[model samples]
Target: MIESWRWYGDLDPISLSEVAQTGARGIVTALHEIPYGEVWPSDTIVARKAQVTEAGFDWLVVESLPVHEHIKRGDGDLSELFANYRQSMANLAANGVHTICYNFMPLLDWTRTDLEAPVAGGATCLRFEAVRMAAFEVHMLGRRAAEGDYSPDVLTKAAAWFQRASEADRDALLASIMAGMPGAFDRYDVAGLRVALAAYEGIDRDALRQNYKRFLDEVVPTAEDLGMRLCVHPDDPPRDILGLPRIVSDGDDLAWVLAAHDSPANGITLCSGSLGANPINDVPAIAAQVADRIHFAHLRNVTKDPDGSFEEAAHLEGDTDMVALVKVLLDEQSRRRAEGRADHTIPFRPDHGHHMLSDLGRDMIPGYPLIGRLRGLAELRGVISALSHG
Candidate 1:
């Protein structure tokens, strides 16, 4: 496997020099400055590549070239958006950046109710409590149909939670749930969130899947022609949330996605932490089954509760068997090597680590503190080393 690290460009508090020290040679990133639905200018790609190269790292994969909201909703004149996305793929390929990671989730990216949930050892990790999310959806956002989405038990817990939450607690909950992504807080508010939810009123799971298929049909060919790979990331929690449809959540969804385009260029980003959030998903089994189609991997773990809540666990300590998953991926790599495939080595990163050591006091991005991820990378690297030699 090609060990990689996700760097959020110049503005990221963690510098490339710092990332280099973590012993990761591949940099997984994206042109986040480019707005959704816009073409990534060639010069911008070159400049970013130059930065990574200068720092002694290869621009291995584009963590995401975001899919526009209009495209996901199948709304408006999508011709221009599709054209722009194809052009972006072409531009990325032109720059020798072939592997692209993206997601088709509508409106929001990966979400968590508590960005700084306290864990053992005085460290903090990202957490998603189902009841709190329900509280936000029903009592806070006051979505018209939010009550129907949760079970009666959850609704009761949510109601109790909402009633007991103080004004400050309510505000914090609202802010955390509403926070879209890093640097995206300004884009979403209660009114805007409601409007976004309203736009998806009629689009259910089937419609969203169809829309995703339409997207693949349009761009996968371009990716193949460019010798580029497009990998769709699984849903963060692997379930429906905020009254919106979640199409890519589990193994079946992954199977459908790969079948949608059935090309080497069309693939999936095997995100263990995200997929493992749902206990039903056997993370190692999924890795082995989709070994050939997994273009990239996010190796992290989460401990799930019976009530649908989960918190980030140490890479090796979570419910998912990290060592077994690594062994499966390594075995796949050996198979690809025997088959004489050029893209044999899979690129992976240690995702969403706990804020520990010096990372505790820093005002870093929620789950992306420097020390935490460095620790995760070191641990994952150790596992790969032991498995390969053992």
Candidate 2:
């Protein structure tokens, strides 16, 4: 495994110099300044790569080159967008950046109910409470069909939760859900969210999957031709949210997409924290099964609740079997080495970390603080070293 760190260029409170100190040699980042559906020029890609190299880090992967909303919806002149995406892939490959991570989730990227939920160690971590999210979907967003999506018991509980939530609580939930993620272009207001949902009104799970297939059909060949690997990130939370269809949530969904474009160039970005939100996903098993097709990995853990809520837990302390997963990854690396594949060693980053120690109250990017992630990287590195040698 190649240890890496995600760096939000230019605006990241944590500098590249600081990232170098964490013992991570590879940098996972993107050309975030460019708007979605536009071309990432070769010069821009080279310039960013130069910055990483100058800082003594390899530009290992693009955490995302966002899939345009128009492409996801199959609406409004997709040819232009697809052409732009292909050109960007060409530019990235031309600059020796071959791995591209992207997602196909419609409307929003990842849905979380709280960005600063208090944890046991006096640190704050990202959390997703089903009841709070349900409250937003049913009472706040007021989606007409939102109630049908939840069970009777869930709906009742959500109603009660909403009733008891003060204005500040409700406001916090709204901000957390609506806030834009790094490299995303789909941030929304209440009306904007409703309108975004309306775009996918007639599209269900099957239709959305088909749309993604169409995208792969158009883009995968270009990626292969450019010697670029495209990795699709799993849907965060791994379930339906606000009635939006979630096509890449579990192993079955992963198999569906992999079969859609059976090529080494078309792969998956295995995110343990995202998939582990749903208790049904066995993180280690999935990693072993998808080892051949995994181009990147996001290693983090979560403590799941029976009611479909979860909080980000320390890397080694959550429901995920971190040791088993690392063992599988090591085995996969060995397998790749035996086969003499150039990209045998997968690039992985400590996904999201708690805002603790020096990170507290720093106005940093949510879920991305310096001290917490360094701690995670150190822990993961220790485990990898111990297992690899033992």
Candidate 3:
């Protein structure tokens, strides 16, 4: 496996020099400054690559080249957007960055109700609580159909939670749920969220899947031609949220996607944290099932509750069997090597670590603190070493 780190470009608080110290040679990043639906100028790609190289590291993967909303919703004539996406792929490939990771989650990226949920050892981690999300949807956002989406028990809990939540609490909850990621340009207010939700009113699971398939049909060929791999990230919570359909959630969804466009370029980013949020997903089994198609991996874990709430756990501490999953991925790498495949090794990163040690009190991205992720990387590296030699 090729160990990698996700850097949010120049503005990231964690510097490349710092990343090098973590012993990860591959940098997984994106041109976040580029807006969605725009062509990534070749010069910009070269400049970014220069930055990574100058820091003595290689830009091994594009964490995302975002898919525009128009493409996902099948709205209007997206020919221009498709053209731009293909051009971006070509530009990336032209610069020797072949592996691209992206997601089709509508409106928002990965979300959490609490960005600083308290965990043991006085560290904080990201969490998604069902009642809190329901509170935000029904009581705060006041989505008319929100009540029908959640179970009666959840609704009751949400109502209770909403009643007890103070003004500051409500505001934080709304911000936490609606705010864009670290470098995102757009942030949604209540009205904006409602408008976004309305846009997807008629698009259900099947329609969304078809839209995704359409996107693959358009972009995967370009990737194949460019010798690039386009890996779709699974839904963060691995389930439907805010009345939106999540097609890439489980093993069956993965199977459907692989079959939708059968090509080595059309692949999956095996995110254990996201899939592990749903108790039903066997992370190790899914790893083995999609071993050949997994172009990249996010090795993080989460502790789940029966009521559909979960918190990011330490890489090796959560419900996922990290050692077992690593063993499966390593075995697959060996098989690919024996088969003489050039892209035999998988690139993986330790994702969403807790804010511990020097990471606390730092104004870093929610789950991407320096010390926390360093610890995770060290732990994962240790596992890989033990498994390989054992």
Candidate 4:
């Protein structure tokens, strides 16, 4: 496994030089400048690679090249859109960027109800509160019959939560819930958000899965032809939310995807933090089973909730046994090497870290504070080294 950190390009508050100093050699990032449907030009790829390399880090992973909404819906001009995606991957591979990490979550990126949920050690971690999201869906955004998405018990609970919230609290909850999740909030107003959620109400999980297959069917072969690897990130929270159907959540879901497309280019980004939010997932088993096709890994953990809520946990302290997971990857790599396989080493980046120590005041991406991640990478580095030697 190669040590890496997720670095949002140019716009990130943490500089590339700072990332290099964290003892990580690879930097995972994306071209945030390119719009969703546009091709990432070769020149753009070179410029960002130059930026990171000059600052003493290798540009090893592409955190995302967002799947366009049109492609997701199988709507408006999908052939052209998929072509653009293929071109983007070709551009990346041509520049020596082989691994790509992306997600197929609908309507939103990952959701967080509170950006500053305080842990016992005075570190602020990102949290997912089901009630708060329900409040936004039912009361703040005023989606029609949003209660139907929840069970009878959750509906009653969310009603009480909505009644209890004051005006300011409701506004803050809405802001936290809907700031930038694809077409919902970034471009739409309150009404448009409601309309967007309503559109997905009828698209059940099975139907959504079909749409995803349609996407992969067109895109994966092109990727294989380009010699690029596409590692699809698992859905965050790993369940349906805001009426959007979540397809990539559990072991069965991933198994179905692998069965559907038997291609190396169509692989997975095994994110422990995201998948571990569901206690049911046996993390190491999943990794080791699919290790041959697993191209990228996002290593982190979470403290899960019964109500589908969760918070980021310390690297070694969460529900996930990260040390054992790392050993699994190492074992898989060793097996591959013995078999004389090429591209045996998998790319891994420390997923989300807490806001700890003096980082509380600094403006950075939620759960991406420096001190905590630096601490985590250092711990993981020692764990792997000791295990290998012993």
Best by lDDT: 3
TM-score of each: 0.97, 0.97, 0.98, 0.94
Best by TM-score: 3
Cα displacement (angstroms), candidate 3, residue 290, comes to 1.0
Q: How well is each residue in 292-323 modelled by candidate 2, as lDDT tens digits?
A: 89989999999998888899899999999998
Off by over 4 Å in 1: 182-186
Kindly indicate the candidate among 2 and 4 with the higher TM-score.
2
lDDT of 1 by residue, 107-140 (tens): 7788889988998889999999889999999888
lDDT of 4 at 169: 78
lDDT against true structure, model 3 = 0.91
Best-first order by TM-score = 3, 1, 2, 4
lDDT of 4 by residue, 1-390 (tens): 789999878768898778878889889999986778889999999999999888888888898989886666656568788888888988999999988888888878787888888899788888888777777778777765667766667667888988988988776666666643642226555677777766665677777788889888987887888788888899887877777778888888888887778898889899998889877898888887777778888889898877777899988989889988999989988998998978888878778788988788899876688888998898888888988998
Q: Which ten residues in a row have the lowest lDDT in candidate 1?
A: 178-187
* RMSD of every prediction: 1.3, 1.3, 1.1, 2.0
Q: What local distance difference test score does each model get?
A: 0.89, 0.88, 0.91, 0.82
User: Which residues of candidate 2, in runs, are more than 4 Å off?
Assistant: 180-186
